[model samples]
Target chain A: MIEDKKTKILIVEDEMIINKMYAEELRSQGFLVLTATNGGEGLELALREKPDLILLDILMPIMDGLTMMSKLREKDLYGKNVPIILLTNLSASEEKIMSAITKNEPAYYLIKSDWDLSQIVEKIKERLSRKV
Target chain B: MRSQIQKKNFEEDLTNARIAAQNVLEDLDIEKTKVEKERAKEVAILLSIGDGLVVTDENGNIMLINKVAEKLLGRKKEEVMGKVFSDAILGIEDKEGKVISLEKRPMNLALTAGTATVNSIYYYVRKNKTRFPVAITVTPIVFEGKVIGAVEVFRDITHEREIDEEKSEFISLASHQLKTPPTAVKLLTERLLSGKMGTLTEKQKEYLNDIRFSNQRMIDLTNALLNVSRIELGAFTIQVQKKNACAIVQSVLDELEPITKGEQPKLKTIFPEQNIMLMLDEPLFRMIITNLVTNAIHYTASEGEIVVECKTINKGETVGGKLLKENYFVVVISDTGYGIPQVQQNKVFTKFFRADNAREKHVNGTGLGLYIAKSIMDHSGGLIWFMSRENKGSVFYAAIPMTGMRTKVGT
Candidate 1:
């Protein structure tokens, strides 16, 4: 078990239940967490708050998670180093996008529909801590 | 003196005999000429009585025209008889808008080039812009080693073609409208079943899952309907993007985990070191995998092995294995379950058609899964086909093309 207060993370997911579950799970794992329901708020929080890591969803209604991630990265919002993982139900589609993003070496990808909720926090931390 | 007298008489007799003989021969020749004229008139009447007729010489100059040809061409014999065959008749275009030409028209490449020619759905157009849809045949008339003239015969066929097109258009429209209802239901039920909206009991959840299943079945139906329409109208759309075949297969396996949950079936997936990447629409392609794999699980017995095989083949013209193209990755799903009957194998990709034994075992499907999978693969320039046999097993293969499926094949 790790110590408390590791890093702050922001979750950008459209579904309220998923967003809540992810936030609580990350917080319980000793990380500060923030969240946004849509891509616009997620972009704002990801830039202004500048969370240590980001978990994005691909198929959101207004301003999808990918669009938010791009906009933030375009402005160089992550201080050129913040890790971002795209968590999505559309894993196949989002994986291609992530592979392109990972060319710049973004965090990683996890399929939400396939992943157990319990594994999210640990996987995110493990991916962020890795040196590629 | 007697010899002289006999010679004079003979001379007189010869002149008279010669004159009489000359007159008799002239009278007989005139009667024969009259009889020949009558026979020629009867032949001309028979030729003119045809549906339509035109005669052109070896050089394709119009030489003779019957009454039907005169009316059909919107001209009298004097006006049209000397015109070249090109100016004599017009062209006919089929439904796809191909100009179907008559087989023996001299200007037609098929005839003049000495190639075996094609007969077209002919439409005769007059100088006045009047048209007659007719079945026309052209016979090259040869006289003494030379094509002296050609005969064109024709009749009308507009009503038949119009009826066929109307029937096809109606079904296409009806199928399109039928598609929207099931799609709407799918989205709505997915919202309810995903726990996105509210909480539900286990039984309620089961009912909702059933609804989802039934709704999905309808979507399959709607897809088959739309597919038929698209093929007929040649309006099918394919949107291919860079995709990972491994991830797609994983998601499908996950989605159908519910089917194998109680059965305790061991699913072994052989994923590659590098992702199997290709170009395809994710949702549409997912449908192909989901249908095939789910059907595999449905037929297999409990504790049976479902081996998901994935491999990437280098791009080239070599087609060796199932759905394996030279330049793409193929995902093959093999099940050690019930195999398809031999008699029912040929009808696999047919719409709304399923095997009798399959229906008895796994009774729920639109029988359009293989058809749609085949359709998607065909659109993407990929391949999808299967191998099966009774009491053996079945392997459903789906190939994904890497290059953009830029080539569009029509219906």
Candidate 2:
């Protein structure tokens, strides 16, 4: 395994336990993981850090994921090119909401309960590998 | 001379009395004509109204059956006149297809109670056995403080039921969306406890297992709710693609293998030698198969034997006189389990209906599985039915058209 020091990822989640668990798992997989508890904090750090990828949650305390996505679209590093995978607990039963979110074509929409940590890590690696 | 004078007075008085009697008789004739005209107007109004109208005497004998009532009940006026109200209208069934009792009939209630009865709904079956939903009102015709007859008016409400179904579907969808967080928690704990991330202590594993189990329950609840909404909304769009039916069932069985691992029931499968190919939606097909198989497993005892057989039948082949047209692909799941009681058999697919035995044995089921499965099959243009006997066993049959031909049947 090659240690790619420059490969950085940003995780924006409101739930403390889930955010910490995801961050720890990503770090173990040899990627630099930066985290924010809400979308507002996530947006500032994402602009400043210019990470290679973003894991965004839909619902948050200060600002939600969709709004943060629109704001990030304005920036240079966090532009449309950087893949943003939605990591959320929101059910995809609502077809309207799902279609709206998928319009921007996020890298993936992974329901939290449907996958394990290992599966998410594998997905991340596959996406990053494709980018490289 | 005195006798002659008395006779003359008597003759004059008699002539005056005759003229007064003629005037009284003319007034009586005018009043009679007025009464007849009012009665004719009432009859005309009943005949011209849109709603089906039926008038029954105090004894519940059919008095006047309007054209609409005759058409709705699929009976002729001549055949129904003078017949008992219940006997003449033999086509009325309840929502469950049970014949409504005579005492419960609206006209009988109005006549017996001597008061107006209004605003009730029931299914009205026609002579040809076709059924439609209807709303009815029965009013007693009271005259001079005596109950004379009762008039019943009913209107078809098929469209109203459809609207109501739509409203419930929206509510179900919203509830389904709310279960996402619990589902996420369950998945996370399951992964950690499975040791995929790292090794865990025995105590830690036990706690995580508890968490996973609770979360899984939440997941199942949400899934059932979502499926119900999808079925009611008629949201199942057939995205037909060629799929191997046997392979799809095998995958579903594999997923369920873990649940049956510890006290597993003896399982058997008989699939066709060639993969049964059909144009269908893979996910929905998987759901129908999974629901039936899961029910069989859950209801069966530890030592019970479960058998699943899949095969194809040629067009026009009939099972018990029910014709199966086109090429039919069928799956039968049978289990030696605590079967459904005979009395509750008709209500198996009804929402929130758990068999008495099933409820006593397994407390985890939400009772929405069969409902969602039936709905899915209906929308997919397939058929699902079952036969069961208490303490014996159950056999569930699911059939779908293998060709482009399909039947859109729903309960």
Candidate 3:
């Protein structure tokens, strides 16, 4: 299992700087990276590419991450079953996120302001391993 | 200025006076003098208002300047008595020492066109040559079909205006600063977590996840502040058009879907008609509904059912007031969420107001959401209110007037 091929990850983010930073960091973990600028395009690509894991930004133009996630869930097609993590800097409503994690149970809920690169990679590994 | 009716009546009186004079038996002499004196006293009473009062003649020369105007404009009644009203009244400048809207000056048009309009004429300059802010209303006084003079009533608003502006600036600066650090932390964390530096231990990953969660909340607060200020300045306008109510609800839910997860509340909407064409502001209505939904979600227990209903109703019947001429088209959002105490319901509309209980629970509220929501409804010619009990949950309603139904109630 440890010697298995690296998982593919798709990051849907609005900000250019953050998207690049996320892609760069994930790639260094030996994971293949895909990027999209908005939730609409992200959904289109996710449906087509079928990435193993998804890292989505909540605040994005052209259909935000949350809406895209629901659409993917409702259809249960393409990359619909992939483990997804919500990336945001918003600090209030931890319970909302926690409950969401427990239910959709994203591999890990990452708050951008507090988590470091090392921590996020660990989450990706942990989530990938804890399959249903 | 005299209304057309008043001018017509005065002309009629003049004709009667000529007829009475020919008889030489009527008491027109004493009655005529009495009427003029009474009118003068009435004008004097109007002049005595705390606001600056100035009366200008046909040529814009200052016919009268009250005490308040004397102090505010740095000119005495004698000094400004015969001066041009345009120069004296228009002399007032804004806080930045530049003239505010020239068209905002009511006296300018009133003096020329015999039109009465209330405007914020500036008497902002202080007695010591410093600038203070004053809001003035100018109305022309006409008699016998001619504008004899114009009266300007003005008030000093130096302190209030300054404070309001200062508060706005502070909020803007603070929110901007608050957002920067969070963005930076979020950026760097994403870098480290994605393993740019090196592989992370399982425990290290858990800790980072925690850090990320807390940071998410900080961002939400900053965003809330941005919304609060936008609403306060009365600029949170909406796109008004005929739209399907169901479409808006679906979008909001879709927007909130990720958070809805397992505890996904049973959300129901009664859109009796598919093309019911809601004549309202979409973006603004979106904000209002989104905020209330979020509040309900936060307060309600997991898996609770929430009902959102829309129906047109007549409001005046229950309000029992002559003021409410017509009923309103309304939408009601009811939640099986934690209910608010009865005592605090009345205060929900106040700016930045939060219930003590809600605060105790550490609810991250700007307290401005409901206030802004109420104000939005108010200015939109609609009404927003809520009914709740200790454990019975809450029902929040918004009633928007249809078409021309929402006339400006009163000034």
Candidate 4:
């Protein structure tokens, strides 16, 4: 009998508790989960491991999510094609996030406070299932 | 003898005429001095003005440029006098940094339209090409029903703009910080309720749900406060795109299904068969519809009905007692609920205002929803109004011009 490979997800968030909560939830949902405390580490992990999808936060300490996404997108075909979902508490009306979404073409932009962990898992699944 | 007498009389008469001529010349000199003094006083007044002032002739020529105007423009009065006003300015840009055309210039608009125009979102470029924001007021100098010229008063608004930006930045930062903990609580509670951690009794599940609900409310309050700050500061950005109005309203209704399920008021929608496409900021539009529909659901009784309708209205059509001036895509939300008191109708859109009857009902409300909705409508070049009778029901109308909302760039 052959074992099926689980879909992998990388969560790049600065807040320790939020990162842990999301990772736990996704792990419970039967996916391999990787976590990074900031965008710099996230980018490094993403380039090395090449997760199926990346969950990025906008306001991180070292390198913000947008800058990291831009660098990763420029790296190679794998980095460019991977789906990245932006998770932020900032209002969608923020010009910086709006323009970044337009430029980076993130899979989805979710407001953290407005969404549930279950709903987020559903979104991730939907994104992964879609054709590239 | 008579000829001698006549000659002497003629000489006397000539001497009298010469004395009268000298008196007249003396009076003329005194009057000239008085007139020159008055002219000097007027020039002193113009030069002493604190704000930049420019006077233009009917032909749009710079007649006079005051001291402050010269300093602000980085050009001396002697250099710019008699030059075309728009040409002499060189670079005048709108809020978006786009060069304002000659026809759109405030001075020219005032001249042509014979009305006063006030604008604060203009950048004036100095001789050295350094630009600064300016708040300007231009009024046509009309004399005897004829426009002779215009008087433009402007002041540098760099300090005011900096303060406004600081305020907006502070609110945004504070709101983000305030929301983080609530978000954590919400997510953690959801994780507990997911039942993967451990088996939970009904009581435990109910308690966890309560915590989640309260946390969500805190998150909502923080968001509402942030929105109010943005609206008050005029710092909200608007991105307009062609969108189906009916579809947007329907989406709002769909999102509210969770709250409207079971024994809640019957939700009804009346949309035109053909989609009404209009330019709108989708999220802002959604926010507006959500606010109105939620209010309708909250205020109406469980057995009552709430209707959401969308239709296109033409010019001269009357809505909410006001005659429309142009084509509009309107959404009407009518509810069979506790209507606003007649006296309180005027204050419905004001900030932090809840009706006496609504407060008595004890339904949870911030009273900021309608105010925020109205502000969004005003900024979008739209209209929001309502008609209600106490103890009967209310009909709220929100209309956006068919041409669409004007895109605004702010914080």
- Scored by CA lDDT, what does every candidate get? 0.68, 0.79, 0.71, 0.89
Candidate 4's C-alpha runs over 4 A off are A1-4, A92-106, B1-43, B201-203, B228-237, B261-267, B272-274, B299-305, B336-368, B387-394, B408-411
Please state how well chain A of candidate 3 matches the true chain A, as a TM-score: 0.85
> TM-score of every model?
0.45, 0.66, 0.52, 0.85
What is the C-alpha lDDT profile of model 3 across A1-132, one tens digit per residue?
343666788999887777787788777668889999999999988888888889988768889877778777766655456889888654323344545556564435566644666677788888888885
- lDDT tens readout by residue for model 3, B1-411: 569889999999998988888666456667777889998998789678887788889777887888877877777777677888767444666434666555545776786787777544254655566776566677888899888778888787768766875786577557755875677667666666767578999999888888776787787677667666655543344446777655776688778777666765677777665444566667667778787777777667776878777665665554312234465556677888768878888888887788876776446677867776776776677777777876668888866666621322110
lDDT of 1 at A101: 69
Clashing pairs in 2: none
Q: Order the candidates by DockQ, highest first — what do you get?
A: 4, 2, 3, 1
Model 3, which residues run further than 4 Å from truth? A1-132, B1-50, B53-65, B70-153, B190-205, B233-243, B278-282, B314-329, B404-411
Candidate 2's residue-wise lDDT over B218-307, tens digit each?
777776776676566654344668888888888888899997678978888988655877887777788788889988989999899899
- Candidate 3 interface CA RMSD, Å: 8.9
Best by TM-score: 4
Q: Give the per-residue lDDT of model 1 (tens digit) for B42-96.
A: 6587566667666666566677678877777677877766777654455454434
**lDDT (tens digit, per residue) of candidate 4 on B1-411:** 999999999999999999999889989899899999999999889878899999999888998889898888898888888988877665799766789988888999888888788988789989998899999999999999999999999999999998987887798789999999999998889888988889999999999999988888888888988998888777788889999989989988988999999978899988864598889999899989999999998888899999999998899999878799999999999999989999988999998899999888745688889999999998889999999987788999999999998788884
* All candidates in order of lDDT, best leading: 4, 2, 3, 1
Model 4 alpha-carbon miss at residue B311, Å: 1.6
